[model samples]
Target: MNFFQNLALKYSHTMMQKALNNNLKVELLKEPQAKIAKEKSYMLYAHIPFCHTFCPYCSFHKYYYDENLAKNYFESLREELKIIKNKGFDFNAMYVGGGTTLIDEEELLKTLELCKKLFNIKEISCESDPNHIDPKKLSMFKGLIDRLSCGIQSFDDETLKKVARYHKFGSSEVLQEKISKALGILPIFSIDLIFNLPTQSKEQLLNDLRIAKKLSPQQITTYPLMKSNLTKDNIAKSLGVSFKDNEFEFYQIICEFFKDYTQNNAWSFSLEKNKLNDEYVSSHHEYLGVGSGAFSFLDGELLINAFNLNTYTTLIKEKQNANIAKAHFSQKERLKYVFLTEIFSGSIELTHFNHTLKCDLEKELFIELKALKICGAIYKEGDILRASKFGKYLFMVLMKDFYTGMDLVRAVFRDDARLKNKDFIDIMREDVDPLNAQNMEFKA
Candidate 1:
């Protein structure tokens, strides 16, 4: 990226970050009316926030595993699901993300069975950690899950140790074997990777790509390391590595590796376009988000569930929804959001933009489009706008910044959700203290 391009990205990110802060001035909610036509096809997003262990780099809502607490959480999850069904709302697809979607086999299966019985869901996608992939578990998830996205941040043992995953999950070889066991069992199996770790080299990045290609899963999703305050600090101090954003260079390597794979989302590369990766936004425009810490974006309104587990369970039992805050974006902002989602998915057809959004895409998003063009991020073919090679990196930047902003949002509510530990600091301690090995010590 040149000086001008760098400046453009920084400025755009700054403005968007500012806008996010201003727009997410969430208000308290007693009842959230998240209703849609029964006939309309939409996606269902369920957030399961329990895991065996917590990664400091992960900013999404999550907690350590506890059986009794998990049982209660899943009960509330079922209540919320039933409430959505009672409201005459329907969905055609479901996506479950988490601390670890498969943390508790029984609870997860129960939830999936209920979801299948309640709605006309055609496919279900769930996230997993390498440790959870076993033959017994794979056999159980046969008909319950259509797609399983396993987090393989890096296949290098040294990198794995740096992130403290070596002890928690396993070495690269163990993880590879565990992940490989899922092939042919599920319809769509995806490898989730993160590039541009602060201390990762170009060769290290290439090695990750090569191994991922060798496995040849149905899909692969790669993200640039998002430098958020809490996560960056944890990774840097825990690993003794400097934090740098070498996104463009890292993305270039990924682009070269996945040149033939279809871009389902800016970060997602897949064998075919028919299968939906973990990103629910690309598959469905509007979705019903259920569970604590899940977000629902329907029409122009954003409904955020309570980040605190206790509060979420209470709210769901009483109101059948866990929403604690809400934000409604302006029409222009909504247009920009649609444009960003479309372009980030690798292409945007003007016809769908004009007809569905009922606005002049060129005029409404003129400023964003202009900056993207100047940065050589996007170009117009006939009526479609496709992201350029460099433009895809810009997409990564936008997504990283957007998610970093979300971390800040999580911080706002983190104070209330530290039920396991004394506070967030203590929670960070669990991840860092166990495997705070020096770079040389961690080197395999």
Candidate 2:
């Protein structure tokens, strides 16, 4: 059978099995109201789950490249897009993320052409390793996308080696030169920098940031070093290292520097428009993620594709004829998903919520958040809301609320009205601390 036929047969079989198990012909919940929808929608992400290599801290679903397998993957993805199109959904913003979307230039264009055909994208972006980008390939994206997010983890060669990033090298001067050439073709670019690496010093971080500032990309996102299970269980005998300077202290310094820098440059401001507004600050807001291990709050639902790429491919093949591995959300789950996405955009504007939603539970959460606002962990301007200087500075600390496990469990089992999910109960019972208040005072 051809790719489409094989895909259809697999999906049909799964639908049949589900129908039999439920003792009813399982029609998908296709009512217009039941459909996920979004307003002021911006950001679409496509996950290319084939990487040249993997980072230890990375838990993204991906595998090494294989020619025949990639063609199948593309076919499955095309089919998935058709299902969404048939449902009358479209997106405004677009982001294409790993496993490194810029693998082969020819294949990359084919994939991008498909995206243009599928989504009504206004502001499209793609992620790439520096090594993967060159003049001609970068030109392919001209007029097709507006932004480029590059993962230039470190300027320090030693740090890059320790993290296994395998990044491209040019002297800071040479690298910036090439980047400028690419920028002439692709505007609205940003760099990803990681701080607090194993045995890394604050001086090193400051130096890297100083160099990055010279390059003067519109934005620079710095994250503290974090260890996932891979690091914890790294039987490879990698050494463990703790913070040399207080991580929070380092974070505060970086935040202050960037805040002033962006303001002075007249780039753009985040959240509400302040007196110090700049185009650069205002534009860092929209993001979308897809693929196995990708998370997105598309429409009103918080959808997480399977974390296992193999499973994702299996399920997508099964989706050719009918739905495969269906999951749904509840009201509370919907709220949390909205909250998380807004939070990621660097703030939450209350004006976006319905007037009727201000009841007890929401009121309580707001009151708590407001206290943080007053103390300066977050900020509120009229109805618009955003992380305060301190909030953005110590984003890692505040991120706990979204991932307290309860939120995740709530998202996954949102469809069940009984609320008897074991995962939800377990997560809610965990001892994660509520948002800390000390961290709130003395804004960055």
**Candidate 1 residues 1-444, lDDT tens each?**
788878878887877776665555555464655555546767899999987876767887888888999999999999999988887888889999998999888889999999999999989999999877787887898988999999989999988887788999999898888878878888889999988787788898899999998998999989777766668788786555745656677887788789898878878888777567577876666788888888888888777887788788887868656776667778988877667766778888999878876788888888878888988989999989998877877777776777776675566555554523353334334433222111101000
TM-score of every candidate: 0.90, 0.69
How does each model score on lDDT? Answer: 0.78, 0.51
Question: What's the true lDDT of residue 361 in model 1?
Answer: 88
| Candidate number achieving the greatest TM-score relative to the actual structure | 1
Measured with C-alpha atoms, the lDDT of residue 142 in candidate 1 is 93
Clashes per candidate (backbone, < 3 Å): 0, 14
Total backbone collisions, model 1: 0
Number of the top-ranking candidate, with lDDT as the measure: 1
lDDT of 2 by residue, 29-114 (tens): 22112234444444555777777766665544467878776666666666666655565567665667776777665676776677
